[model samples]
Target: MIAHLADIESMEKSFRTNLINHLTGGKAVHLIGTYNEHHQSNLAIFSNVIHIGAYPAMIGVLFRPIGENSHTYKNIQANKQFTLNQIPLSMVQQAHQTSARYPFGTSEFEACEIEEETIPEFDGPFVKHSLIKMGLIWEEEHLIKSNQTVLLVGKIQYISIEDSILLPDGHIDLGLAQSLSAGGLDTYYQLNQLTQFPYAKVLADASHEPRRNS
Candidate 1:
C-alpha cells in the first residue's frame, strides 16, 4: 500500500493516474456549462472545483493542460461566463458521459440526452436535474508552470437551490439534495451528513482541544 515517488513513476500510466487522483479523497462533482460566441453549448464534468473566498464569493476550477482542446475552457475564454451545476445522484450516469469527447459544436446536453435549462439572464445553460446551480463570471486565469494546468477563478453572480434544503443560517443541506461526489476519475458516491459541530473557540482557562474519536 506504500507508494513512494519512484514507485509511482514506475507504475503503469493508467494505474498511476487513478492512484494519484484517488489519493485526494472525495471531490465535488459538477457539470461546467459554457457557450461559444456562436451560441453553441458545451458541457463537461469536473471534480477540482474549490472555494476561493467568501467575501467576493469566488470559486476556482482546475482545467487540464493548455494544449488540450478543451471546449469548456475555450468557451469560458470566449464569453467569460459559465455555469456550475451540482451533479445529482439520479443523473450521475448522464453527467459522467459528458466527459466523453464529441465533435466540435456538438452539445453534450443533447448528446447525453440530459435536459438543459437556463434562467432568464444567465449566459450558459444549466442542468435541469441539478438541485443546486451557480452562474459565474470569469475573473482570471492562473497557469501552473509545473504541470501546465490552468486554474480558472470566477465570481459567483447567481445561485439557485431548492428551497427545502436551505437552512436558516444560510447553509444548504447537500445531503437533502442528494449531491454526488467522486473518489477518482470513474467512481461516484452519494453524500451523507454525519454530524454537525458548533463553531470552536479556545477557552480562557484551558485550551479547547478537539477530541479524537479513537
Candidate 2:
C-alpha cells in the first residue's frame, strides 16, 4: 500500500492513474455542459471541478490536456460559457456514461438519454434532473507545466438549487439532494453529513475548547 514516487511511476498506467485519483478521496462530481455557436451541445462528466474563490464566485475545472478529441473544451472555448450540473445519486450511470468517447459534435445529452435545459441568457445546457446547477462564464486558464493539464477557471453567473437542500444560512445539504460523489474515475459515492462545526477562531484561553457542533 505504500508507494513512493518511483513506485508510482513504475506502476501500470491505469493502475497508477486510479491510485492517484482516488488518493484525494471523495470529490465533487458534476456533468459539464457546453455548446458551440451552432448550438451543438456537448456534455461530459468531470470530477476535477473545484471551488477557487467565493467573493467573486469562481470555480475551476481541470482538463486533461487540450486535444482534438476534447469536444467539451472546444465548445467552452467557442462560447466562453459552460454549465456544471450536480449528478444525482439515481443518475450516476447516465452521468458516468458521458465520459465515453462519442464522435465529434454528437450530443452526449441525447446519447445518454439525460434531459437538458437552458437558462434565459446562458448558452450552455443544464441537466434538467440535476437538483443543483450552475451557469458560468469562462474567465481564465492556467497550464500545469508538469503534465500539461489545463486548469480552466470560470466565474459563476447563475446558480439554481432545489429548495429542499438549501439551508437558511446558505449551507447546502447534499445528502438531502441525493447528490452523487466520485472517488477515482468510475466509483461513485453517496454523501451523508456527520456533523457541522462552528468556524474556528483563536481560543479565548487555554481552558476554553471549541464547540463540537454548531
Candidate 3:
C-alpha cells in the first residue's frame, strides 16, 4: 500500500516505507556506479531513469537527495560526462549492494567488486560488465523546490549495445537479451519473449525463410 504524506516528516516516513517495499522482491533495477568528489562515494540504486529523446539522444535521471553534493552529482558537474552501463540479469546482487556511502575517494569499483574502464579523456570510470554502455555529456541541471532533488539531463556521445541484443531493422530483442525492469517503485523483474509484434516501418530484408519439406 502507498502511504500518503502531508508534510516533510510524513513525506520522509512515506519515502522510507516506499523504499523498503520497493526492494522486497530483490528484482528492482538499480543505477550502479554513480560518483562524486567532496563527500563520500555516493552509490544508490535507482529505478527512476527514463529515455527522453532520440534526435539529441538525451536521458533523464531523477536523483533524490541523500543530502547535498553527492559524489555522483559532483562528478557530473566537474567532468560534465558520465557513463551508463546497463546491468545484466546476473549482476543484481552487486548492484543492490552498492547503496552504501563509502568514504571519499574509496572507489565502489573496488568495494563492490566492479571493474572500471578509464575512458580516454574523462575523469570517471565505466563498469566493465554492462551490455549497453552509453557515454553521455551533461546538457542541463534543473532544481526542484522540495529539498535537494535534482533533474539531470544528459546527451549521448557514444552508444554500445551487445551484438546479441541487436535485432534486424534497428530494434532490440529484450527477451533474448534478458533485459530487466523495476516494479511498483522497487522490485526488479526480468523480461522474456511472449510474442513479436509487427513493426510500423522498416526496410524489407531480401532473404527468405527455407520452405518446409512435404
Using lDDT as the yardstick, the better of models 1 and 2 is 2
Over 1-214, each residue of candidate 3 has an lDDT whose tens digit, in order, gives 5444544345566666666556544342545344564523334456666788998899878777746436676777766777777767887777766667766677777788776665665444667777777778889978887767888998988777889888877888877666677664535688777877675765598457788899
Which ten-residue region of model 1 has the weakest summed lDDT? 200-209
Error of 1 at 2 (Å): 1.9
Off by over 4 Å in 3: 1-16, 19-44, 66-69, 121-123, 184-186, 196-214
User: What are the models' TM-scores?
Assistant: 0.94, 0.93, 0.73
Worst 10 residues of 3 by lDDT: 24-33
Model 3 TM-score is 0.73
lDDT of 2 by residue, 37-113 (tens): 78988899999999999989999999998987998888888899999999988899999999999999899999999
lDDT of 3: 0.68
**After superposition on all CA atoms, what RMSD does each candidate show versus the true structure?**
3.0, 4.3, 9.5
Candidate 3 residue pairs in clash (backbone atoms < 3 Å)? 22-186, 27-188, 28-187, 28-188, 31-46, 35-71, 35-72, 36-71, 36-72
How far in Å is the alpha carbon of 205 misplaced in model 3?
A: 31
lDDT of residue 165 for candidate 3: 85
The segments of candidate 2 whose C-alpha lies over 4 angstroms from its true place after superposition are 207-214
- Report, for every candidate in turn, its global Cα lDDT versus the true structure: 0.91, 0.92, 0.68
Please give the ranking of all candidate structures by TM-score, highest first, separated by commas: 1, 2, 3
